[model samples]
Structure formats: C-alpha cells, structure tokens
Target: MKYPVLFSPIKIGTMEVRNRYVVPPMATGLARADGSPTEGHVAYWAARAKGGYGLLIVEAAAIDPLGKGSPWDEPGIWDDKFIPAWKKVTEEVHKYGAKIAIQLHHAGRQTTHDKIGGQPVAPSPIPCPVEREMPRELTTEEVYDLIEKFGDAARRARDAGFDAVEVHGAHGYLIAQFMSPYSNKRVDEFGGDFMGRMKFPVEIVKNIRRKVGNGYPIIFRLSGDERVPGGRDINDSRLVARVMEEAGVDAIHVSAGVYASTQYIIAPAAVPPGFNVYASEQIKKVVNIPVIAVGRINDPLLAEDILESGKADSVALGRESLADPELPNKVAAGLTEEISPCIGCMQACAGYLFDSTKSNISCLVNPFTGREGELKVEKAEKSKNVMVVGGGPGGLEAAWVAAKRGHKVTLYEKENVLGGQYRIGAIPPTKQDILKAIRYYITMGKKYGVEYKMGVEVTDDLIMKENPDVVILATGGVPLVPNIKGIDNPKFAKAVDILEGKKEAGTNVLIVGGGMVGVETADFLGEHYHNVTIVEMLPEIAKDEQAAVKFFLMERLNKYGVKAITNATVREFLDDGVVYEKGGKEEKLTGFDTIVLAMGAKAYNPLEEKIKGKVSEVYVIGDAIEPRKTLEAIEEAARVAVKI
Candidate 1:
C-alpha cells in the first residue's frame, strides 16, 4: 500500500466507492418542514458530489414521521411523496459521477414530534435528558413494525436510485437507545444485557439487507462512546460492530455521542482533533468490514494520515465538507489554496441548525458555500464599476462576488491589512488557522481583479469621489465600552488589544465578560500565563454560544485552571482588581494585574442610512447592520450581492 492509497477504490458489497473520501451524513435540517426534500437540500448535496467526493452520504432522513428528533425539518423516506424528491437528489449526484447513499434514522426518545405532530417512541419509557418529555414505550409487536419501517425506508432509498442505504445506529438514536444501558432500562429481551440490547440493531441491518436484496450495500453507523457515565464505551462498541458485520452490514460508519450528551456529539474545543479515531481503530480490529471515521477530521493531512495508518478504511468529513465542498477535489488536484478551512466554530452549521435559523449554512471564509449553483460567477451585463467599503468578511465576500461576475470591484479598508477582527483572532492560540482563511480571501480578491486599497478608509467624500454605480458598506462594528468608572483609563484594554499585543498584561488577568470571546481568550491566556479569571453577571459562561462550543470552552477552562464566576456583577474597577457583588454579598478582591473587557460588540450603522438614499444601490452588511459571527457576515453579503 502507498501513501496515496487513501484515495484508492474500495467495495462495500455490490457498490464501489471511486475513492476512500466519504462525505458522511450530517444533519443539516435542509429539508422542508413536512419531511420533504427541498431545493436547498438538493443543491447542497449536489455541490458535494460535484466537488469530487467518492461517496456522498445524504443527511439523516427519518424512517417514520414519529421518529423525528427535533423540529429540524429533516427529510423522510417512509412516504411515497419523498421518493420522487429523493430521486432528483440521486440523479444530480450521479450526474456528478459520485455514489450516493441515504442514511436512515429514528430518534427514539430523542424525538419531539414538533414537525410531525406526535409523541416520541423509544425502546423504554424514558425521555431524553435535554428534552424532558417522556417517550411512549413500544410493545414487542410494535417493535416488529418499526423494524419493517426501517426495511421500507431502505427499499424506498434503493428504488429512488441511491446506491447504498445506511442504518443510523449511533449517537443514542433509536437503535443506540436499544444498545445503551443508560437509556435502555427495559426488562424485556430487547433491553436486558449487551447481547439483548444489541439484538435490535442487528435485526434492523438484517431486515434492511433482506429488503434491499442480496448485493445491495447496507452501512451501519455506530457511536463508539456514549460520552456519558453508564453509557456504551469502546469495548461495548466493538462487540456491536462485530454483531453488525455478522448481520450483513457492509460498512461501519463510526461517529460519537448523542444530542442528549451535548458535549460528546459536538466535542468541545478542548477535545483534540482526531480524538475519536482510536475508537474506530478499535472497532476495525474486531470487524472485517471497512470502518468510516468522522469527528473533526478537518485537515486533509490529518485525514490522509488516518487512512494511511489503516486505522480506518475511509475519512468522513462533516463540517469540513460544509465549509468547503471542494476540499477533496482541490487536494487531489494539489490546489490546496482553493480549500476553505472550517474554523470548528459551529455557529452557522450546527448552531443555526439547532436554532432553526432560515439562512443557509454559511462558512466564515467560503462565501460560495451554499449558493454554488445559484450564485455562480455569471458575466456582468454592463460590467459596472463597484466600490466596496471595509475589508472584513462581508466586504471581502462582496468584492469577490462582484469581481467574479466580471464587475470592476474596488475594496478599501482603513486598516493596514484585511481580516478586521479575524486578524487578531487568528493569533488566539488554538485558532491560528483562521488567519489562513483571511489570506485565502486576499489571494482570491487579487486573482479575480478586485483592487484592494489598504490604509484608506471610505468616507462619504471618498465614495462621492469614486462615483461608482453601487456602494457596499461592510464597515464592520465597534467595541461597546461600558459606562463604568475608570473604563476610560489607559490601564484598561480591549480583548483585541490584548490579542494584537498592543497592550501588556500581567500574569494575573481578569476578563470582565464571560461570552465566547472572553472565555476563549481566557483559555488561550491561561495556557500561556499564570492565572486568568472570568467575571460574568449571567448564570453561565458562554451562554450566547452554541452548547457544543460551550462544552469545549468549559472543559478548557477546567484544564487550564481558569476561574469562572456566574451571577456576579462588577461593581467597580479598582487599580488592582474589580469589586463584585454575589449572593447579596459585596466582596472587593485585590489582584496584581491587568483588566480586559470582552463584553461584546456594537453594530456600526452610522453610515447605513447615510449612504442608502444617497447612492443608486447601497448595501449594508456584516457587523455594520448587526454584530454577529463571521459566517453571518459573509452569508448576508453574498446574498445581497446576488440580487444586485
């Protein structure tokens, strides 16, 4: 075997993957509210196939309407209406020369029935920890019916032209509920010991294989660890893997955690990259079939190493694929610069999915992510000159989109360089790769003939001088300074100041706010310096952040000895440390060092109304409209540019 063997073809039953790069199923909630495939879902998956993935596993589709885990609007294959819509997806994927697979799933106790309008059903009468509603337990006869539903869904997928069908048995889902002792407490045969608990998943695979016929491929996705105490671990997972292979499973797609164990499903930033690979390696040792590994397989080199070491047969990219669908294609062509890196900040991807945000999944760096087909670089009609103000995510995105459409785009920034806040953020220890994305956009701006003017702030006068047809104001936002006493003192520093090394701090530092920015900075500083404490008035740290990221932030805080206090209000700032009030007690603590404020940001809308009516078409995006994460900025900018 050679190093490039990772890209070699492999067979799973009658189906053959063109290469070992598998686009694993990630629940994007891209479907319609009624479990039907929407145009957005079709376009999203088609982009992956077009990007040269050997195998594309569609996002989880419900086997039965009652199996819905949340109100995420996931597609369903149990109904006749879904077959034609799914057939369109298969046809699109095949046209791109890629093999497609549909991952069939049931949420069990995790289901909320919000979209389908019903209560959840599970192996035992247990409710998910996060969602407190109790699930109705299914009888043995009902269990048989559910098993047939799995088969029916698989048969529908096969008839719809999907080359393979995957039974989702991981992440404490319906099948996993039967396998996990922590969730499955039923005294019956389906819930007693390991073998009995394992029986349900094995039966599903057998029934799926039988329904799909002799040579059809049936992949079983498994979670190596439940990430909860008394939950299934690697040793148990290995046993389950063997049982799946014996029951005619062609592949074992390995992932980790459940939505119930928030930290496990979305590993915290503290968890090392490729942290879950060891479990897949362990499962591979027990099962003869190929094992697919997924979990922060962001870097192509890391992914290559996993495949080269024989730890797993294939690498499944979840968020990485969303960030840049062309990663595998670019790597194969040795066009690494074209790849847009996923920052692992699940804000738009998993976070928005959970929040039910209507905007498509956006990459902080990849401006052309979800709208690849719709927002292609069509030649401009008149090739009008365009002036874009600011050099942040929004400005860069607008400039690129305009230039790609053959417009003469000029971008001006007040700073000496691009990236805005991201430039400072990239140096924040664990987030060094964020800078690479900024550099990629700079290169793209140049490649597409977008003239960039650094150190030149675009004011109303500057815009009037340019006299362009359109003016896009992506000027970003300003930091919000509180009205506290001593806030104006030179001793105080902004989080950006600390990141940029413009201000010096002692070994002991206290960050005023416990948001994501504050917490991450604390983690970075704590790793390098002596002591760091975060003071917040809220009940928890990183409350505005997604649960997945918050879990990781909390873990890093614990590891780095960073102190976090909640429900504490900062009364006043002293020369040494800030005084606080907690639980009706006023305590003044004297510290040896510097104070950094990481509260939040304010939208810089001073120029929006100023330029809107004055110009032919004025576009205000990014932090200029409202301060948010980078993904939101880039997506909004691109969306507006498409219409203009």
Candidate 2:
C-alpha cells in the first residue's frame, strides 16, 4: 500500500509482470569475450530478482557476430551455445518470482573494426560523429538479413527461457542509427524520409514477432529524443511507437539521448531525475501500448508519481538498481529510508565502462553489486569491540558492517557532522544527492546500533582507554599545501575551505590543479558568475575524472566562460597573480583577486601509527590509507570490516 502503482502488476502481451518496476538493459561487460554469461552475470541478475524486482531485462546481447558493442565481454545471442548460459540466468531469475527479458542489440557504427572483426555497418556509409569511422552501408539484401538476425535473436531469447525480449534500438545503436537522420543519410528505402528511416526498426519488430509468435511479449526500447540538433525527437519517436505498436510491439520502453549526448544517456548527478519522463509522456499519449520511462528515475517516490500521473505504465531502474538491488523490496516493505540511494557519481559504473581499465560494472556506494556471490557479510566467529575513527563514508560503512555482524562498534568523529570531505564534495551544484548517500550511511550506523560519539577525536590515549579489540582508521585526508613560493599567503585558500564555506573566493579567481575536486570547485564558483581560470600541470584538465563526467564538466566550464590552461606548472603565487612554467617558458598570468589550491589531498593517518600496539588488530581505510575515490574507500572498509 506504500506505493500501490509501483507495486501493481501489469500485462505485457500474454505475460504478466508482478510490478511496474523494470530493470532495463544496461551493459555490464560481465560476460565472457565469446559472448557467454559468466557466473558473475548469473549471480548479479538473480540477486536483483530475489530483491523483488518484478521484471529484469538482462544487459544487451549482440544478435550477430559483427554486432558486438565492445571488443570486451558483452553477452551475445548469435550462437546457440550462448543460450545455455543465458538459460541459467533466466532460470535463476524465475526461481525468485520474477520474469526475465533479454535485449537483442547491434552496435552498428557505434562499434569499431577491432571490436567486431570488421568495419562496423550502418544504414549509410557516413561515419558516426563521435567514433568518426566510416561504416560499410548495409546492402538492401543485408538490411533484410539483419532483420532476420533480430528474429533469430528473439527466438534464441525464448529458447533461453526469457519471458520477454527487448529490442535495443536506442543510444545510437543500429536501430537508432537507422532512425536518426543525423546518422542515417542513405537515400535507400531504409533511410531518407521519416517512414523510410523507421522502415528498418518496424521490419525488425515484425520479424521478431514472426519468430517469437504474436502472443510473445516484445519490449521495444528507443530514445524518445536523440537530443542532437538534427536527430530524431519525441515527435518522431511518437510515430515510431505507433508503427512499432501496429507491428505487434507489446510495451515501449522510452529513454533519451544518443551517444553524442552521452551525459543524457548514463546521466550523471548534474542531470536531474526523471529527465526522460516528459518524452515518455508524449509517446504514451500517441500509443496504447504500455510505455516505460527510463533515465535518472532513481527515487521510488518519483517512480510512483510518474506512474500515478499516468505518464507511463512502468518505471525502468537502470543505474539506480545497480546501486541497490533491493530497492523494490525495501519500498514494498516501507523501509524506503534503508534503500541505498544512487548518488549518480557514475564513478564505478559508467566511469569504468568509459575508462576501459575496469569495465565490469559496479556501484560507487554498494560494494556488493557485481560480487554478490563472493562478497557477503558473514557473522564473525567471535564478538569483538570495534573502534572506528572518523565518521566519513569509510568509517560509517565499516561500523555498520561490523555492528551488523554482531560486533560492539563505537564510531568517533572529530567534527559534529558524520560526512567528512563528502559534505564538501556535495556542496557543488547538482551534487546534493551525495548528502542523501551520507545520510543513508549515518542511518545504517544508528540502525546497526553503532555507538556514535561526535566531537570525539581518537588518539593513542583514547584507544588505550576504550580498549577495543579492533581499530579502523578512516581519519580521511587533509589538503596537500605544496611547498610553493608565496603559497603561505593568506589570499590563497584551499579548495575544500571554499567548498565547505570556511573561506570565500573573490570575483576573479585562479585555481591551481584540475583534478576532480578542482574542476567541481570551478563549477561551484562558476555558478555564482565568478570569473574562473584553471591551471593544470597535466596534459588535460580533470584527467583523473571519468570521461563522461569530464566531458560535462568541461562543457559547463565553457558555458560559464571559465578558462583552462593545461600542461602549465605553477611555480609560485604572487600577491596579484600566479607564476607558472609552460613549455620551458616562465609565464606570469596576472589578474586574480584570489587564488585557490585544489592540488588534491594527502592521507591523514596520524592515529594509525599511534594506536598500532594499543589495539589487537589495526586496519587503515579510506583517505587514511591513501587518497582515493569514494567507491574505493567504502569498498575497502566493507572488505576489511566483513572479515573482522
């Protein structure tokens, strides 16, 4: 009764989903390179299903050999050999009272030759604006053949025990490429006019319906608006929805943005929640099929509102589900506050996907996302008194985990507040969602019966007095004030101080260093119409940030008229200006009312060495161990706490 609409069952074709919640397809890169599901994939999906999600749409699986999105481990339905692996996932999901669906995908021009073993194919020979690789225009015969390939994929999905199959026609993939004039410039019947452009996807739906039968559920996911200048918009999507509906599509899952508008695709915290709802609403009016709204629809209340307002029949949780797989169960039980909020940092999720270093999707706040099978909170062999220093994310998580495992935990924070640097990190524009995450941890600590002692700085004497069996130092970090000339001047302030409101910047400002903190600071200051200039010693600004985040940050900076100078090393600070070296030349850039140093932080582990012998077990986590991202800090804390 808490969320009747959200918990209400809905019929998609002949199948009935238990609720309006749908886990839309998101690429995890958790499969084998040969396009087979790994044990990780099986465990990941099963956990979400067991968590009470009504329906789970598995991540995109290529329909053919050349359609694979990345050179890495993206699942595929091209081969029957892959069916058994996906069948394992569907069977596991079904065991938990959930209906499972698979998204049949084709990368088209979005992929590279190195990825698919040949040049990527598209509706036209034109290359993608971002990828900039010319694709071999699919011959008319090849286009029909590709349609049959989609049918074959749908058939395989049914054979694999999936209740429904969603066609991946969004986010600048093959179907989207053909629909958008921006990507599809071909004069053939598959392109050109609106109906011509939509011909490919319509035929695809018909082909899928033919293979899966008229009664089989078919979910068609498409970008309601490509968000590009000349790209397909909601009006076009409305027509496409009608066509697909007439072509036997069961439900329409509406999302927004193409790859070029990448920020709108994954959607960082900077983008507001329910961004694609308007688009879904527009499409819903034109079509009778159940319309599912996606894109930053994180909060359960918002999902309920969207459904209650008659915007869409279903709400698709993408990255939000990754942050907390048990979101549905939590909401259904009226334990909404306990639901871990997706902060939308995108650090481990989209960040890893774009970075190519750590491509396996994971959550920033939830450490047990991908490793549900491996990383579990088992009860400790013996109860222990745990002393956690600092009430930042790391300490809070450690305390919560330890206390949940039946340990007596005391969490100490030198300051009155719980969040450490995270509070300052959330001070940036559109980043207030982070405070929700901090509040969740604080609530978890209290719920787990952690003894929270505010304004209590843990020292050697305090550790000895408390006499705890284990001590975790999440003392966090301090600003690294580099030993530069004139750096001690009072006019220069730390980035954290400005963000924390302890210090203020003037109208004209110069920030030294262009890391995540510095860039976010510039954005925060830029919002106030401050004239900001960023100087970075690296080749690129915000180099340490995720690609999509950095892209949006740079766009914001440009919009705010913030200037950036990269590969410029600051030598000294002047009373009126800053001196730096760039390309072996000494340059003096003068004209700043105040100077800010966002040169990153140094680990603050003062108590670790002091309390080593005082405690039975000593562990260091978070910035106290080494300055790292929030994801690493929380994960490290959980990893250490669970074992203890």
Instruction: Rate residue 459 of model 2 by lDDT.
Output: 79
Candidate 2: tens digits of C-alpha lDDT, residues 1-644? 48889988999999999999888888887888888898898899999999999989998899998998764678889878888888898999999999999999999999888788899999888787778788998999999999999999999999999999999889999999998888888888987798899899899999888888888999999999999999988888899899989988999999888878888888888778898899999999999989999988888889999999999999999888998999999999988889888988889888777666775888888888888878888888999999999988898899998999999999999999889998788998878998988989888888989999999877799899889899999999998988999889887889988898889889999999899899999999999999999999999888887766777777888999999999999998899778999999999999898889999899999987777676789999989878988888999999999899
Each candidate's TM vs. the true structure? Answer: 0.93, 0.97
Query: The CA-based lDDT of model 2 is what?
Result: 0.89
RMSD of 2: 1.5
Per-residue lDDT tens digits for candidate 1, residues 1-644, read 13386678989888888888888887766677788887777788889988888899987889988887645677888787789999988998899889999999898888675655788888888788877778899898888898899999999999999999999998888899899998888777787888889888888887887888989999999889888888888998988899889889999999998766766666534457888899899999998898999888877788889988989999888778877887778888877776777777677667766675445555556656656657665677777778888998788888887887888899999999898887776776567667777877777778889999999967787777788888888888888887876667678888888878888778899899998778877877877865998899999988877777676667767888988888998888888778889999988767748888998899886666666667798888888887888877887878776666
Candidate 1 TM-score versus the reference: 0.93
Residue runs of model 2 more than 4 Å from their true location after superposition: none
